[model samples]
Target: MKLGEPTLDQLHIFIAVAEHGSFGGAAKAMGRAVSAVSYGIAQLEAQLALSLFDREGSRRPVLTPEGEGLLAEARAVVDGVDALLAKARSLHAGQEPSLTLVIDVMVPGEVAARVLGNFRRMFPTCALTLRIEGLGAVAACLIEGGADLAIGGPVIGDHPALERQAVGELDLVPVAAPSHPLARPDVAPGESRRHLQLVLTDRSPLTEGREFSVLSPLTWRLGDLGAKHSLLKEGLGWGNMPLGMVAGDLASGALVELDLPEKPGAHYGLSALWRRDTRLGPAASWLVDAFRDGLGD
Candidate 1:
């Protein structure tokens, strides 16, 4: 006998029956008649040449081993189709299929979390990917189309292909463990230069040969801020960190604020940048607005 094609509607009915454990229950849940739900399942099993339900001895039909295996496959297929339809509908409404957001490590944690939470609720159908990078790497991602948005640093110098908007400034304070030599009250500029300064280095060549607020001759260049925080706490080196990130450390005496005579504390600007040519989708635009608004605080 020639096999028939199983329809999506049949699969939906099969899933409902498997989940509800009986045709009558599935019919009640789906607002269909019991006979219709049973017939759909029977047709599906016949098309696939499988005995899905065993009706020999049970009060309610129970799944055969074959039926148990097919149930999971049916649910996955149904869910895949649903997701495909959702993505299509989202595209039809001008939503992006996915967004790539690259953030500078300096961006305030609270602001990033609030904006991302809002983005998820506002654009449930769109996918989001996040990358955390420091300095020039943030701009490189935007320039190379590796990211849809960037929330970070001294944006790769005036590029015509990029657009930047001010977010807020992070207060970069030089700090060290209280036991570190530089934290002493009478530490001189020449004396401080001998101790290691943990400086965040950029891999992107955009800032090659450039250093920011580096006052020490002996230095350790790191790519991650978290690593710098850890090294500072270990009395390994002294470095600048965002005040928001180290406030607790400062207050708890785990780390002490350094008073470097050559370089005082500085405010580094956080900005939102994107490709000038590619217009942002509604979700991305909304996020940019949220970040700009948060800069007020």
Candidate 2:
């Protein structure tokens, strides 16, 4: 059966009222005047040759069985309409690619800053915006076209069209201030076993199952390296450091490295992604490349 339909705004208003059980509730949700919302629903009913809301003999309107059926169809129609609108908005938001890049909080501290800094320097015309979110959220923003590009951890799942490239590896080293007793250049063998670790725990520290010092006088837990560093520099506790972030600090003696028995590093990679099916406009395409060139990705 060929079905003709009411417009999306009308359909949306219908669904809002259908779900909310009151025109006034729907109006509040839609942020539309009650009269406008009512008119939209009325138009939707007229276009469909169906009475969507039950008229209680000029009393408060209610849904009949037929109205119940219409509500089901209305929900599906509204959802599709919402998706179509979102796709259009994503294109508009991502088309030019002249917007901000949000970096995940877990991203390499140096890489995030460098990527944005170089992106702006290379394309001064394109405004560079920065934000912080979780790794999963960063990927979602890129896919949703809300964010142009992000430099963060490896995105799980298959994204054939999305460009996932590695920019650098993160060498996680136990680090501390020169004033700390653990600031040693060489561990003859098991010397590091006695060192106390200031750990970051969104979960147990990655070093938990490994052969290393556990701060048995267990103290000083931080969720962010920035916070840990602030405390570390204040002589609060010793913790692991991203080599990239502390390179300058280490060189200038602002921080010192504690020797590890072996290489303990997380292979941190930066990935650039976009929809395979969609063509980024000149501006967005250029921004993608600017990100690559920044990291030499």
Highest lDDT model number:
1
TM-score of each: 0.85, 0.48
For model 2, what is the alpha-carbon lDDT of residue 288?
A: 57
RMSD of each: 3.0, 13.0
Q: How high is the lDDT of residue 129 in model 1? A: 97
Whole-model lDDT, model 1:
0.87
Candidate 2 residue-wise lDDT, 1-297, digit = tens: 444578878878887887788888999998989899989878877777778788677556688777788777777887776656755664665544356566656556555567566655655445556767543556666666777665555533355545665544455666778887667666556554455556654322322343332433455655565787777776666776667677888899978876656443455555655556555565556655665565554
lDDT of 1 by residue, 1-297 (tens): 888889999999998888888899999999999999989988999899999989888868888999999899899999999989988998998889899999898888888898889888888788999999999989989888899998887746677889988777778898999988888886676777788889999888767888887777888999989899999999999889999999999999999998778775788888889999999898788888888887657
Q: Which residue pairs come into collision in candidate 2?
A: none
Q: Compute the lDDT of residue 9 as modeled in candidate 1.
A: 95
Give the poorly placed runs of model 2, Cα more than 4 Å off: 1-100, 105-129, 134-137, 140-148, 155-163, 185-196, 199-221, 274-280
For candidate 2, the TM-score is 0.48
Q: Each model's C-alpha lDDT?
A: 0.87, 0.64
Instruction: Quote the lDDT for 243 in model 2.
Output: 71
